[model samples]
Target: MKHLSDEQLVFHHYQVSDDGHSVEAHLAGCEACRARYQALQDVLSAIPVTPVPERSADYGRQVWQRLQPRLDECVVPFWRRLFERPSLPSLPRWWLAPAMTALVLAAFLVGLFWSRSRAQDTLASRLRQELRQELVADFQSALNRSQERSSNALAALEARLANDSKAEARQLVQALHDMLGRARAEDRQMLLAMFRNWEEDNAAAYVTLRQDLEELASLTDKEMRRARSILVELAAQTPPPDPPFRINK
Candidate 1:
């Protein structure tokens, strides 16, 4: 006789069972078919309804007799007969179904969100680094640029101080010497124009000069202080900028 197909073995395993001789033969001789049958059995077993209550042999005969009238009436179609017992085959598949569901849920969450794993840093530590880098860089760049502008400005101040009618004034002479060679020409001319207009009509450049002066003053006091105070403790012993160049006749 021809051997049974897996589908036949599966249906037999679930809705019905083959005899012990066929089961043992399949297990001993055909491992593949036997494994498939066992898998089908596991899946089917997972969705177990209340086991049909054991009754006397008359019970099956009674069910057959009741169904025979319905069969004759053709009240239920063939497909409906196929599903007199509900089956959720996709759900209870030998542990694989649960695993597949979990895998899909995990993939969806991962697709929706990219969790930033900062095993590289602790919470406060990461915050500190981010703040330090951002604030320090901003402060440092602004400090350097303002200092550059100040160097140019201090130079012009010295030049004018040196040229004062009272050239021998102690504070003026000292400041002139201290500020020698620092102010750039462009900056000096700019400052001169500012001062000249400040002299004329005094209020002519009020709004324009007021805003400029405020910004410059803020750089000098607020921003520069914030930037410089950060470094004061780090190198308190170090001397200030050395002045090596001298250009005067």
Candidate 2:
């Protein structure tokens, strides 16, 4: 025979099943069904039952009173307020068309002004960049020209020095004087100091050479030949160039 289902057992336990008598007869005959029903009753009975706290008659009123301030502070959004229709004076129906046209015109004017200002700013920036590039190019060109002139002047000075003639020496002195006249005060002072040092070294070399030449006649043939070779080597050596002049801004 089929045993009573858990649903039938539960309904029978609660005294709600329509066939409670038949379920009870089945449980009495089947030991397995009776054991299952007992287990279900034990599980339900193991659960803890809680009692609800009693409230006073004015509980709802007290809750509503506590929440009323917060509700009053609730801010309705702008869009919702618009939908609720705020109390403002109504405009004439015919004025709407002209007002819309004016709004569109204002927006167009603002956009046009902004675009023009941006264009002007861009143009100004481009012009400034171009001006800076031109200035740099001009500065580089001037620097190159100055370097070229200085090189040429040094080459001429070297050529003059190579000549052993008194005329060449006079020309060199004249050229230096001309340069000193054109130079700034600080450059003139530096050039003068360099010239003084060079003059002292040259004077000393000249005195030494003169003494060696005078003593050559008293020396033996082999010693004279050695002295002549030494003199030739000294004459063959080139003098060092003067410091290059630079203009400081």
Candidate 3:
């Protein structure tokens, strides 16, 4: 058999009943259970209870009398209290649609203005970019043209300088040739003049020898013929004068 629980004994000691009568029957038959219930009753009886005080019928009147002066001192006017609470007045059913329509119209207007401003900004930025691109292209084209002109000018200057240098070189060579030809002609003329002086001196000596030979007729005729032949060979050996030198400029 199951023993009675302490909760059942506690409820019984308080004169409170539960859903079953098993605890009362067990207390009557079991001495241990009955003694436990008696001990629980004794402990509950030993604790003291604080009693609630009763008020007289005039308690509310007394409290109202004491708080009335303070309430009056802190009281606000009707208009001041109305503003502090800030309650909205009731609106007619017809007002709802118009209020919502006004709110939506204001939002649409703001969106349209914002979109227009954004589009204007985008168009301005595009125009500025196009202008900048055109300016850059123009500058690049001008620079290319300027560079071409400078290159052409430099090429012409180089060609002119080359032609002048060639002309100067030709002139210098011609002058050198003329100088060489003149020196050769002068050397030839000096050689011819030296041979002529030698011829004259030999002729005078031969005349004196002939006179002496006439005086001394003891020489043989064969020796005289040999001497005359030698003199004729010497005169034939003299060279002619050179021609004048001419150089084309």
Candidate 4:
């Protein structure tokens, strides 16, 4: 009779609980398999189960008492928070759009409000007064750099959205989702509404793409030819996702 391997013995030990017929048959006919199984049993038996110590009732009561005051002070119940919100003024029908537009403009202004201060800083003014003054030009150049950076960011976003890889596309979408999730609730809703418009426009733009391809192909210019060549290269490489909005169930 052939002796079992250590792996076989370990497996046999596991199956022993369920009545291993092969383990019994091998052990009956072979000394080595039985010795291996015994070693497995000894190894397994040495492992220990540790039990958690229980606290006395007095200790648990003290912990609860300590937490109770903190919980009372810090955590208002959901119902209280819901009812405690200041009652908003009854808004006019036209208030929502104007309010959002104002908020966005205000935020934009707040973000860039330091540009004028920086340009007119006492040190900056003194240095510039001694030198040539092209503060307006400096502002224009700064603005141009900002515009370029913004355009580059948008182009990168567009390229990622157009990319073929599902992982990259999902990552791009998830980044937007996470950013919108962290925004203020009212701001988030306005942003979502804005995004819905962009999505609609994108859907419409794809249709316009198919139509414009024929128009683009028919155009008479070297630039138009180059555009068609690039478009054709893109279209040939990857067809858009079927049921484009269906990202998986």
Candidate 5:
């Protein structure tokens, strides 16, 4: 025997099929089919239907009017939708581009500032070095010129002293020659007496000359000592040159 299908039984239960009599007759005659239909009816009847809440007649229209903007918003542009979607790291999709651009720009600015600072430092250091080199060269040149001046002054002083000494010696020789010629022209007896007197005066004069020479020698020694002290002081007062700069690299 062919059993009625579940579709026919459901249709018979709901009275939806055109041929309901045949499924009803099968359910009434066949115990298995009858039991199945009873079980289905019992299960369905056991489930309670929830009652829907009642509202005013304009409620649907009002709700649709309120939600229309949101539904319209749902039809977002493709670009906006793409940006609104989130990806990895829990970051918002909209914030990614601006954040990346800001980060890249910040990094570029930092690198630019650092490079500029380094270049400024290098330029300042070079300027300082050049200034120092120029000062050193100037000081050395001044020192050389000073040494040359001192040498020339010392040479001139020595030459002047030599000329003065020669002039003094020549004057003394001329005066002595005049005195000797006058003595030779005088009488022998008178010359002898004059020589005796001259010897006595010469001895006295020689003693005075010896004392004057000693005093002049002392004065010369003091002058030489004073000049040496002045030279030492000048050398001490001179400033030293700056040390050269060194680079580790």
Candidate 6:
């Protein structure tokens, strides 16, 4: 079984514990906790209670009356004592009208001067504001014009560059076409020269073969047989001819 703490017992004694029933059940079952709780109750009961004194209905008035003599001994301010004394001479009634008129005139003059100064200041401020606004407007107008001019210049430059590029491209294409036409003409001339050389070589080879055949035909039988054996030996010793050269269209 769990024992109750002193704080729990104190809360239970004051009936301030949220789990009052559980504390009570624990105290009933636990002998040590119950004895501690009983000692706490005895100690609290033994402490003396101090009673508050009651005040009468006229207490505030009685306090004021008791302090009146001491308050009276305090020094009065010089300005208040001077006004309270009866020995000072009073001013005459005849001078009051002129004094009042002079005071009113002075106040009116001061007010007029202040009003004029304020008017000048306001006008100066308004002029400054208008000048600033005009300066800003002029600056903005100049800036917009400058930006527009720059934009137009940039556009013109881009257009010029584009035209130049197109012209250059056309020239390059024409140059390439002329170069290809020249190359094809050179190739045709080279092919025609090779064909002419091949025809001349074929004619020479035909003339030599005809001479050899006529000499073989004019020989005796025995000489022909000897010549045929020598030819067979030469044919056997010679390298084979290369294949014909051909060109694709």
TM-score of each: 0.21, 0.32, 0.31, 0.18, 0.32, 0.30
The list of candidate 3 runs beyond 4 A from truth reads: 1-84, 88-98, 165-249
lDDT of each: 0.77, 0.89, 0.88, 0.80, 0.89, 0.92
Considering summed lDDT, which 10 consecutive residues are worst modelled in model 2? 82-91
Q: How would you encode candidate 1's per-residue C-alpha lDDT over 154-231 as one tens digit per residue?
A: 999998877885755877778886677465666888999998877886766677889999999987898778778878
Instruction: Please identify model 5 stretches exceeding 4 Å from their true place.
Output: 1-92, 167-249
Lowest-lDDT window of 10 residues in candidate 5? 83-92
Model 1 is weakest, by summed lDDT over 10 consecutive residues, at 112-121
Model 5 clash pairs? none
lDDT (tens digit, per residue) of candidate 5 on 132-173: 999999999999999999999999999998979988899999
Candidate 4: which stretches are off by over 4 Å? 16-19, 49-249
- Say what the RMSD of model 6 is: 25.8
Quote model 5's TM-score. 0.32
Task: Give the top-scoring candidate (lDDT).
Answer: 6
Estimate candidate 6's alpha-carbon lDDT, on a 0 to 1 scale: 0.92
Candidate 6 regions exceeding 4 Å error are 1-84, 87-98, 166-249
Task: Tell me the tens digit of each residue's lDDT in model 2 across 1-249.
Answer: 898888988898879999978898899999999999999999877887787899999999999999999788776777887788567855689999999999999999999999999999999999999999999999999999999999999999888767756787898999999888777777878999999999999999999998898777556677878989998898789686667996779
Worst 10 residues of 4 by lDDT: 11-20
Candidate 1 ranges with C-alpha deviation above 4 Å: 1-100, 103-135, 166-249
Q: What is the lDDT of residue 193 in candidate 5?
A: 94
By TM-score, the better pick of 1 and 5 is 5
TM-score, candidate number 4: 0.18
RMSD of 4: 51.3
| Candidate 2 clashing pairs, residues 3+ apart or interchain | none
Q: Which ten residues in a row have the lowest lDDT in candidate 6?
A: 82-91
